[model samples]
Target: MNEEQLFKQISLVRQATLKQLESVTEAQADEQPEGFRNTIRWNIGHIYVVQNSLLAKFGGKPVATPSRYIELFAPGTKPADWEGDIPSLDELKQELEEQPLKLKEVLSGQLDDEAAQPFLSLPTVGEILNFTIYHEGVHTGTVKALKDKAAK
Candidate 1:
């Protein structure tokens, strides 16, 4: 896809993900229902962290996310193992809300550039950004399921 289209998709997908959390409470954000490994909060933070990290790592953009987010939400980290202060749901939402614009600002005109190192054979920055859209959708679905279960 072209850079404009790709960034638009990123924004739209993020909006859908945020829409899923419209009714989620702070308590619900932290709830790890049975059969789930992480909470809604973790999924949201992961989405933010992964997108920014990929853009920085593969797109030659500066890292816009805080280091603490990597420690809290990077792959293999889960709510069950979390320690220290975590961002509130609102804070995460703000980050989520702002991320796409930040991505566009940083990555515009650079989408076709080759990755510093290929990831999953996604050799171009644009391809990796495309992957993040799918990744975020998966986590957004998880957030939906977790929210439903937590409401019970």
Candidate 2:
């Protein structure tokens, strides 16, 4: 689809995910739930980092991930021994809200073109955006489940 549409989809997914996270405590985000695992906070940051990398590759403006998260989240670069503070859930959600508008501005009239190229397992940015839609949904479910577990 077009850039506007892509932005809309991203915004929708992020908003819904943020809604699920509303009123969530730090404890809930750190808890692991059955079937739906992973701290909500981690997954949220994970998705944000993915998007940042995707966009950075598309335009190469953001440089690389900070040394810390790079090892933890980079492709084929799982954390060996990471031990540091990560961005809080609120910070991540704020970035989710702010970064897209900047990306949309830079990507105006370029979404289809940029996303049309081959990248990763998917060919084209469009494919990645589509994948992101479902990716967020799956994680959203997991986060919701985690919240359920934390409530117990």
Candidate 3:
């Protein structure tokens, strides 16, 4: 997809993800629904860190995160096993709100620049941006499904 379309997708998904996350209380965020993968809280932090890391692969550093969170919530981890420094629900929400704008600024300025490098071996800048949107969709869907289950 073109950078403009890609950015629109990111903006849409990030906003929806934030709305879903905001619906849950901090207490609800503490526990994963049975047979579910992650608490909404974990997904929030994971989304933030993964996008940040992806940008870093292209030599654009994301805001620093505590090492403990990296160990606890990185991909392939399950919620039950997480034992890292969990940020407050509010902090996670704010990062979710802020990251897309940061991403947009970075991408808007560099999409055509020869200086922009591949992130994590992604063949194109488009691929890296797409992955970020896809990642948000995954967790946003996860959180929505879990919330539905909790409601029922």
Candidate 4:
């Protein structure tokens, strides 16, 4: 699929993911349910961070994510290891809501451009963006599962 179609799917997935967070309270978000490695809040932040890191950092585009977000949620980091001042679920939701629009702005007309350094096997910007979307969906599913388990 092309960039427009891929972005549309990204927006849809993001909306659904945010909808899933609407009922989750701050306390619920912080819960690391049994068998889970991270909290709902961590997953939410990770979702935001990973896409920006992959496309903006790896793809060499400008995406204005706070540096702290990457520090807190990047792959090896966890809520258990976070030191202080974690973003609330509402704050994360607002960023999540705006992410796709920002992404579209930065990446407009550049989908065919090749990545500066290919991530995994994704060689072009479009391919990396597609992989990023898939990554988001995976985390979104984990968010749903964690939210459900946390609510119990």
Candidate 5:
């Protein structure tokens, strides 16, 4: 598939993720149900962080992450260990909602362009972006499962 299609898929997945998070409260977002290592909030923040980080890494744009977002949400960071203020679910939703558009804007006409470095055998911006689609879907599924457990 091409860049436009990838962007559309990204938007669709993001919208679905937002819908899943629609009625979740801050308390609910913070909940880590049995068998889960991270909370819903952590998953959401992770989605935001990973996407922006990929674009910045492959697209060569500056990361626009909020202060400490990387520290809080990057790989291996966990909510159980956090000791500071975190972005509200509303803030996370806003960033997640806007990111696809921002990516489209920054990456227009550049999707097929090669990345500076290959990511796990994936070359090209589009390749990494396609991997991100799968990545987000996995996290989205995790969020759904977490939401279900949290509701119980």
Candidate 6:
């Protein structure tokens, strides 16, 4: 897809993710239900971190996430091992709300540029950005499931 279309998708997907967390409290976001390795909070933070990382790595944009976000939410890290000051649900939601605009600002017109390296055989910055939509959807689903489980 083109740059405008991709940014639209990013905004829509992020809106859905933010909507999914509308009712989640800070405490609920922290709950790790059975069979789940991470909490809703972790999933949200992961979504933000992964999107920024992929965009920076493959799209040639600078990383927009805080260094500590990588420590808490990057792949292979889980809530059980979390330490230090975790961002509140509100803080994460704010980040999620603002990320799309930042992405569009930085990545506009650069989608067709070559990736730093191929990822999953995807060779362009836009293609990698597209992959992040799928990644966010998976984590958003996880957040929904966690929210449901937490409600029970």
Note the Cα lDDT for every prediction shown.
0.90, 0.65, 0.73, 0.87, 0.85, 0.90
lDDT of 1 by residue, 1-152 (tens): 77899889999999999999888889989988779999999999999999889878766667577999999999999988889999999999999998889888878888888888887899988999999999999999999999888768
Identify the superior model by TM-score, candidate 5 or candidate 6. Answer: 6
Task: Choose the strongest candidate by TM-score.
Answer: 6
> Candidate 4, residues 29-62: lDDT per residue as tens digits?
8888779898889888999999888887668777
Q: After superposition, how far is residue 23 of candidate 4 from its true place, in Å?
A: 0.3
lDDT of 5: 0.85
Please provide, for model 2 over 1-152, each residue's C-alpha lDDT reduced to its tens digit, 9 standing for 90 to 100: 66667789878887888898888877666665655435676677676677667656743334245555554555443223336776676777787677667656665665445443355667555566567678768878877777777778
- Extract clashing residue pairs from model 6: none
117 Cα displacement, candidate 4 (Å): 0.2
Q: Per-residue alpha-carbon lDDT of model 3 for 1-152, expressed as tens digits? A: 67778788888888889888767888888777668767887887888877766666564444355566666567877667756456889987887788777777756755544324665567555577677788878888888887888788
lDDT of 4 at 133: 74
How displaced is residue 64 in candidate 2, in Å?
6.2
TM-score of candidate 1 relative to the true fold: 0.96
Residue by residue across 1-152, what tens digits does model 6's lDDT show? 77888899989999999999988888899888889989999999999999999878766777577999999999999888978899988889999998999888887888888998888899998999999999999999999999889878
Q: Which pairs in model 4 have colliding backbones?
A: none
lDDT measured at residue 106 in model 2 versus the true structure, 0 to 100? 61
Q: Model 2: runs farther than 4 Å from truth?
A: 34-37, 58-67, 74-81, 114-117
In candidate 4, position 71 carries an lDDT of 93
| Local lDDT at 12 for model 5 | 94
Q: Which stretches of candidate 1 lie over 4 Å from their true place?
A: none
TM-score of each: 0.96, 0.76, 0.80, 0.96, 0.94, 0.97
Model 2 lDDT-worst window of ten: 73-82
